[model samples]
Target: MAPPELHPAVLQSVALTVRPTSGAPLALQTKVLDLEPQPDGSTTLVVAPPPGLDPREHHFDATLAWTYPLGRMECTVRTRPGRRAYGDVWLVCANAPATRLQERAYFRARLTVPVLLTWTEATEETEETEETEEQPEPVELHGVVVDLSEGGLLATVPSRPPALGTRVEATVRVDGENLTQPATVVRHVAFASGGHGVAVAFAEPRRHGDRLRAVVFAVERRRRSRT
Candidate 1:
């Protein structure tokens, strides 16, 4: 059977793995900014590049994975530097067709709760800071959890979202228990309600993976039972 055609709407978020000529594979979660259709029926994906990686530096063998309605899908493609689209975003052309992958390990459940995010922003080095050796203070932002899963959760904040690949500590209360996990900023999205949504992947998912799975499963069961 021929591979299915992927639509841009369905390709909201994706996990990108890029292998450099010399170095460890860089894995990141990012959102698709735009899609360009080609004459040969292929599509070029404009996406957020991993932090500190210059697309102009080298070519890469990349694997793109995303969750589809039926299941998860992925494809391998060769990527070369394309024109810079906007701030911190670049284009990568997928030169191959996608293949179906196994079903997702965990289903995301809609859950609304309060979340506290803590992260630090880089500051310019100064003479005083160099002498003191003090680190920058961590900034705290409060948001609401829109969905939950074993892998990560989506939350929205009033202010501009943090930069991608930032390490953050997220704390959420579930069932009277406060769960804190170290997570990475994966993607940023805007909502119609005038706030920004940030998607974060748990850096140490195994620490609270079981608890999150249980909560998600319970939510799923309750929703199904009502219908």
Candidate 2:
């Protein structure tokens, strides 16, 4: 079936393994189809996956990049009826600043480290590759977020330490595919072990504020997958 058209604010991208069992075409680049902002700071981005997906695979993952100016803050965005995205983060700063949206989207590409992210779904344990961690890692942290700010996070990572000044990147993984980015670790301290914590940083913060917001959004996503 032909993919339906989306609004202007929505964006889409696709990545498939070469040598796929189904022998479908190689991966193709994705583009944003439509976009629109919500009154409550959430976004309405409509996206569609690539064509010719494997019938058996039944699973496809895509990366979404939403960039709004400084004044226009947004934190949440939903794509369709089946998928609802939460965790709205905004980079709070004065003036929009001179920057390009493409450059800002770069922050979404920092998941090279390979992390093993685990979350609970339907009372059953689910796991996804957060990064490329070769060795087994243990760190089950979960909690509700108090607020979402620009380039910083306030959450409850019971066993996570505040990775202050240590770069914290975002790694989006699904069924084993991974994409990552290098974020400047700004804050990673414990509010109270087994209670709540805070980790604040940016993806490539040296460049400017453009990336600061990216981390904000990425972390918000991490929070959602947990809940």
- lDDT by residue for model 2 over 190-222, one digit each (tens)? 221124344343454444344434555576578
Output the number of the TM-score-best candidate: 1
* TM-score of structure candidate 2: 0.24
lDDT of each: 0.72, 0.34
Q: Global lDDT for candidate 1?
A: 0.72
- Candidate 1 residue pairs in clash (backbone atoms < 3 Å): none
C-alpha TM-score for every candidate: 0.55, 0.24
lDDT of 1 by residue, 80-107 (tens): 5556636656566665666655465656
